[model samples]
Target: MSIFKDFLLKFRESFKGTKPVIHSVLGNVFSMRVIGNKTHGDLAEIALTEYINEFVEDYSAVHTGKEKFRAKKFEEDISVTNKLTGATFPISIKTYGVGPLQLSTNKDGSMFSHLTEIVSKSEITNSQKIKDILKNPCFFNFSKVNVLPLIYDEKNKTFKIILFDLEKAYNSVSKVTYFPPRKYGKDRETFPIYKFFTADEQYIFEVRYGGAGANALQRGMWTHTENASPFFNEILNGTYQINEPLIKLVSKILVSPREKHEKILDLLRQLNGNS
Candidate 1:
């Protein structure tokens, strides 16, 4: 190759690669900076799914008074059994973070929406027990509910865990209903979830819609990992207001929704005129 070409090739190689900017934002003014995962912390709802048990166990020694503790974790919550009472009641936890609340009530993946779709067309919806449960459909039936609050602060680089009882936190929900664009892809409208609390609860989170989150409906539940990192503000010593969520999907109430849905979905195998 020519000397000039060789020089050009070597120079191009040096500029060919650069570390990827994992996150970026620009508005009002002109400025640019490269950022890493360190900037955008893991949103709390995400932290709950990813590290609920770990953080809970991390703080359990400091918080609860129960004994012979055995635990189990599912999507967004945990159950600590007071072995003395044989109760594996679920307690909720979350890392303080940003983004939308995303406990979908009637969305596709949601247990109730999925079941509602199934039962509406099936015969088992006729079962007395099932009928009684669906008659109200209030709060959309969920399991082992209690709320425990937690804060994962980016500044301190630590998780400040707080415990809460959903049983006492003003058990109420908005029951929002709306249809999504074709992109969301469901014949029915969606219902995002929200669990509220009285002043006594440790934390509260809210999404001020107008940005991307508004475009995609969210607020309330452990939605995704992308939103886990949150800004933490301390009030009353680890007592901040969190938009608390009640663990509505009680296994005792729904009789194992996963199993129930699975069995019922087996229409060829589970259906008959009267059996």
Candidate 2:
């Protein structure tokens, strides 16, 4: 018999020789289990297939030659723009799996040296050739590049450049690694590092973090708020008066001298007390 068939026979025999009816009952249970496993596997495959198809279709639509905006690549930066809004933004995307490398470390420096050696060995020697070599999307060094946020002004048609500060952002992220496997020396040989390295990892960097990190969130939020801000400003612009009868009454209760704007101070005090 084939090795697979022999293995199945051994698995089947493990539940046998109890009683005649018991063996039959256990065989039925085993059959049901196998069928259920196959059904679940098939369903998962179908669902994955559907998701891939939908994603490909959506991607093609967004990236079609006639699409309004497309990703632009400069010497070392990438800028994504909205063709209709005249808004342009620069974004730096980086990976986290590769741990931070210190500038002074020999091992880190050697890695770059190794890369330089490989590039030098290549036939092309011109600046354009060097640019083409660096353009390979796979080779990303986390220690070298940091993600920076770019803001766009719809009114002025200009991009705002901001520095990235990632100080407290890493603290907020849950350090959970999915599908943890038992640690074994041989396991390293089987692990697919390339596949895992390609997967996109999400991190949260809030507004208060400051620098490049803060810029990242600020740029994204500003891009979203640009259209809504004018409408909101119009509705709320004339609602308050400098010296209104009703405003003076509320201002006395909540406004303090240290605060610059009385109207804003009262609102803040109310929110602070409520929270």
Candidate 3:
């Protein structure tokens, strides 16, 4: 009997004999089906798909086209700019959800070390050109890097940015990689199944599972954005033009709901008719 077959046999016997044997055959079977054959590529595709779906659902629920705001990361705020009167008000969008795993391997350290070596050489030689090259975003590259800066728009006098954190994100899924069994013995091709010990000897199987690695967090964030970009562009840019007049109306309605309700309603009706 093969090692796997023997393992199954033992598991089957355990379930047959006693009621309190803590039968895990079903659990083991289910685990194997889901994670047993997964590859790194498979997990990545799944993660990316889920990240996009969740982002779109969450974003639409919170942002209604009625508000005119620009998102900015540098100052950590979304600013509503009044186009008509040229006034600006700061606003913020907060997202709560599951975040990705944060892990790093030796490979990441090696790349960083190499870049540091180059930077050190450039500094010692007093090469301003080399230093400038090193300072460029493309030159100082990594597998995962986050550049979140407050962008200034002097033309419009507005800043907009979004901050999102996923809720219960990790528990979304589990995965494992697959590996074939190894062969040994003189007649490995025809080795008897019973050669695998059953009675006294115990066997163990260890499988590495989960997309747990460095850059997982950044990858997850990228996945979410890639999924959401289409919808955001469509709704914000394509469907509705967020202008100064809209921002002022939204701000007024927020402060004076009773007085502005009818006027706001009228404006929306007209806007809809134009559309």
Candidate 4:
């Protein structure tokens, strides 16, 4: 059996902690329908985290939060803990099904890319959860982290990512996040009145930090994502708009040439063995 399949098949047996719903994207196709509804997202998540814990020096996998957060702990889509520096941050993945919308504001001359969120409520309210972590001394192990953003295109099968220093970005650009909280029954119209993420400045972001060869926002090792349009800060007075599109980006991950899957499987095994 392929290493990926071996790990996945052993997922329930090896890791019996959290349950992140699996999803995937193989080249152009968003998600490949195998069983009823299962993809490599969750499986990859666990395998990657385990690999991080095992092989990736200076970093550990932190997918869950404090106990009080309750159902909110699992809000994190991807988090990396710097074992050496004792820092950690999360990468928030946002999907746009109908591609991305370019909104030009009439009030102010500004062009913003708008997208709908196809994730859980906790995904948006992560700031509150982060706030909780920031307050807890236990999380001091992860003293620093960048709240990175990844934009996945559903129709076009592409991704536009923004890697910003959450602290600096917040202080510099004007930001506006409105994904509702996890407090049950919060409809689409429900706005996150509490703490959220947006920009406060318009400075140029030094996109100097280039690709991780692999982006773990698959967010860790053995992962090289495709169809991505990564951007750093550009001169901007207007903000990027976000709205619910008819089609959301919630596709699955599927690779072609079959061997690609085997390659990932091999990488996973190598990492697992190292860990």
Error of 4 at 200 (Å): 13
The true-versus-predicted C-alpha distance at residue 64 of model 3, in Å, is 13
- Candidate 1 has a TM-score of 0.29
Residue range with the least summed lDDT across 10 consecutive positions in model 2: 190-199
Expressed as tens digits, the lDDT of each residue in 1-275 for candidate 2 is 32222322332343234342222222222222233433322232232223222322211112112122233222112333333444433323221111121111121233233334443223323444333433333123322332332222323323222233222222222221222223668554221100000012332221111123223221111111232121111100001112233335434544555454665657866975632
Q: Candidate 2, TM-score vs. the true structure? A: 0.16
> Model 1 off-target regions past 4 Å?
1-78, 98-108, 111-138, 153-275
User: Which digits, one per residue and each the tens of the lDDT, describe model 3 over residues 72-125?
Assistant: 312112223333344433322221111211211122233233334443222222
Q: After superposition, how far is residue 58 of candidate 1 from its true place, in Å?
A: 17
RMSD of every candidate to native, in Å, equals 24.8, 29.8, 25.6, 17.4
Q: Kindly provide the TM-score of model 4 when superposed on the true structure, using C-alpha atoms.
A: 0.31
- Which one is best on lDDT? 4
Give the per-residue lDDT of model 1 (tens digit) for 1-275.
Answer: 43222322332343222421110110100010012232222233333333323322222111221231222223223334332334343444333332332332222233334334443323331245333433343332432234333333333333333333222221321122222222345564334332222233222322112223333243223332223222222211221222212123222436665777666547624453223
Q: Pairing residues by index, what is the TM-score of model 3?
A: 0.18
Clashing residue pairs found in predicted model 2: 163-211, 163-212, 164-211, 164-212, 164-213, 165-211, 165-212, 165-213
Ranking by TM-score: 4, 1, 3, 2
Instruction: Write model 4 residue lDDT over 1-275, tens digit each, in one string.
Output: 32222222333243232431211211212332222123433433444455546544455665553242244422344566655556565532222232221110011111011112212223333455435433443222222322323334444444443333233433332332323324556553222221223343233121111123312111111101221112232111111222123013222224255677677678868975642
Higher-ranked by TM-score: 2 or 4 = 4
